[model samples]
Target: MPNLDDKNAIAFEFARICSLAAVKIMEIYKTDFESRGKDDKSPVTDADELAEEIILAELEKCLPGVPVLAEESFAAGFRPKTDGAFILVDPVDGTKEFINKNGEFTVNIALIENREPTAGCVFAPARERIFVGGDDAWAGTLKAGETVSPDALDPITTRARPSGGMTAVMSRSHADEKTLAFADAQGVVEKVSAGSSLKFCLVAEGSADVYPRFGPTKEWDTGAGHAVLNAAGGCVRMPDGAPFLYAKEEVEYLNGGFVAWGRID
Candidate 1:
């Protein structure tokens, strides 16, 4: 039996699952599928549903009986028992980008334990890129419909803060006044735009310095990317420098304002 407590094994297995789901996502993406709004008015497509289904089935085999708070499943009112550690999944992280065919959308999965993400994977199908976090973080290319292997992946880490000003990455669509102000207050010299959890991957690979968001988000939306950033020598924290915790049942897994930095030091 696979060791569920082994983060490296978990990360790699989760990544393989994400890669498999991305193949189905890309297959539907190439079709003329329609997108519809959920009860919360968020966009969802067949790709999202099918991808989540694939992930869930694989999770049953890999880590049976572990509660999964998957976006599609939760939206469909299938709330599993999640009193203890659970898995968070966002089958399609950037629905707008997917709808627009911008190639920024991703499939995200993370193991959430004790209010922290222990391991995770983020796979962008259109971009053929995958990032995984275990005992460490790694980035690699995996073509849609291709099998995944960690041997080719390169270890990734965040860079030290630049001596000058920081390069801030913001949401391509979900920008808010608070996030803009935060960037300005930090004296950001350069700014980059990204959709979905790719902002976290950018920072994890040292391509950006920070990503700040003070707007609405769900635990599923950030868990995978947060794990990657954390394992890559970066971290996510409240603007006040407090730790970012998850499993907010009172808020239905809603996440508050937080910033992701390449390195706090």
Candidate 2:
């Protein structure tokens, strides 16, 4: 139930925070970035903490009443208020790629209502592109170089079917054995890897045919991408073919398995 007129303000504000976080990340990327480990053994960095700090602070100011579930702050015992809905934030996705200075990392933010994503935004700071969408609109993609009118915003679309030669997308830095097996099972003829939610965007824009993620991913990691893909005539489905839902009561907020596709023809 987010108003589109107001959504831009919120999205713009989040974008600013993300941009700031991206700058901090870039600063770290330029130098010998520090590293540490979470209990799950996933990597963490100064960039992640700094960006999360900035994003969390801004969310506090901008959306004071709404509860926030962020990746960096989740381990600190912050359980979401499942009574209704909330916002999910991955202040920095693709931390490994960020560390590699590949510029494919992104800031992902999504507004979940009643366990469904109503609006979301993704910013590729280094690439200077931003993607934003809501249920009422076909998500819009903006790059640093183009002039786009509001009316000229293009609607995203998924491929009608898996291309003649399936082009499967995997994580650039986080590819796992299960993903490799899934791609092989699907008989993928081409494989492309990208960092962050760009995997979803690739399928949305028809650049790739499918994204099968068998590895672990938190709700925040896919909420924004889910909205984008759904708007683009694609879907994120559980392994058993159910639609993905967020704000589940589970404490971990971890997703099981999902296959993103334009369609399964």
Candidate 3:
């Protein structure tokens, strides 16, 4: 087995898997498909399940014995045992946007070690964007049928917090007064409405200063994006300024409110 600690390699493998899975997702995206709600009333589609199967199979080969915590599988009651080291995946992160044909959804995969997300890949297939991170971070544009190439990517890092009023990216569907109030209190001058884990990518690529989520989320929802943000010199923290860790099986991997931020200075 490859060194599990070699985060960059892991991220690259995830990027490849995301690229391959994206082909399947786009194939489904162009057709008229049906969607239904899971037990939680959240949307699910053929895209989600198929993309998940692709990602899960790839992860098994790349990581070998390490378990995975994937959104669709867990929702289907397939909980795998893990010991602080596992993979996290969200196949279709913006189902509403996807169902609406807005092209904001993503395919996400991450590697977690000791409860910290150490590497990840987030591919917005419809948008032709891909981001991956580990000890380093990269962003690039990719088209259908194209796999990730290191030469095609550019290194990315969060910019220092703007000297002026900050720009905050908030959830397009889940935005509530709490998030707006947080933005207001943070002296935000402008806000960008985004869907899916792309909000976290905005911070990682220095396009936005911060992303605040007040709603409950699953570890798979944030893990990949968190890894990208972290590798780009940013971080995710609890509202109380505590480290945001993962692998919360006790609470079914539900993540509490937290803030993802770029350089403070």
Candidate 4:
């Protein structure tokens, strides 16, 4: 179990790693590349594999033996046991958005200990925005050709649920009737569509009140964003009102429905 100081340090490193992966993703995003389907029929591209390779290499150098469960790697049968502390990497979240050139994809990384994401970072290269949360939370922007650094970030936090009604952010690619119904039940005053983990970041920054994810998502898909939300005074929970957890070997890393709330009350 890492202490607060250790977790913060690791969180900073995770942000840097996500930034590097984001840069690689943006490079490929600007190219004329094609996507192919994975075994699960999810779209994957060279950017996903290339960015994951960069992130994995850096993780091995920075924290050797700390198990990493990355999207592309796991899809290729690299199932390393995550007994203690481990890293989760989604090299290019929102691949469909990326393929469509919607500029909603992101590079995600998280540090999980005891089945909880203690620290994480989400970087949207196309948008030049980075959101990090752990012992602290921050939102930052990157200029073209700029590198990521701690000094570039500004602290951010969640706001209380509005007195009127809450704003909700939903997935642009995966929105379905069930998700819309869930949002409607929450009394959402306004709805916004975004791709990738940015939905969680929006709630963390107080720009939105809640994000109900009724669609199927994997641990890597939400771990980093979950950490960010938690650090920013938010939480992600099961639809049945249980705390969301990670490293569920019994489920083969698949996550069920969840609600990420900016205000838990």
In model 1, what lDDT does residue 224 have?
A: 98
Residue-wise C-alpha lDDT for candidate 4, range 1-265, written one tens digit per residue: 2344566667777777877777668878889999999999999999999999989998888888889999999999999888788899999999998999988988899989999999998888889888888788888896434565667788888999899999999999888898889888888989999999999999999999999988799999999999999999999989989989999878778999999999987
Candidate 2 lDDT by residue in tens digits, 1-265: 2243465445455555666666776677678877888988888888888888887887777777788889888876777685676788997788877777888988888877778776676777778766665643333554432433335455667777653678988888778998889888878899998999989878877788889988788998998777777766778888778877888666578888889986676
Question: What lDDT would each prediction earn against the true structure?
Answer: 0.92, 0.75, 0.91, 0.88
Query: Residue 139 in model 4: shift from native, Å?
Result: 0.5
Considering summed lDDT, which 10 consecutive residues are worst modelled in model 1? 143-152
Off by over 4 Å in 2: 1-13, 136-155, 184-187
Clashes of each: 0, 0, 0, 0
RMSD of each: 0.9, 3.4, 1.0, 1.9
Give all TM-scores, in the order shown: 0.98, 0.85, 0.98, 0.95
Cα distance off (Å), candidate 2, residue 58: 1.9
lDDT of 3: 0.91
Which pairs of residues have clashing backbones in candidate 4?
A: none
Better of 3 and 4 by TM-score: 3
| Comparing 1 and 4 on TM-score, the stronger one | 1
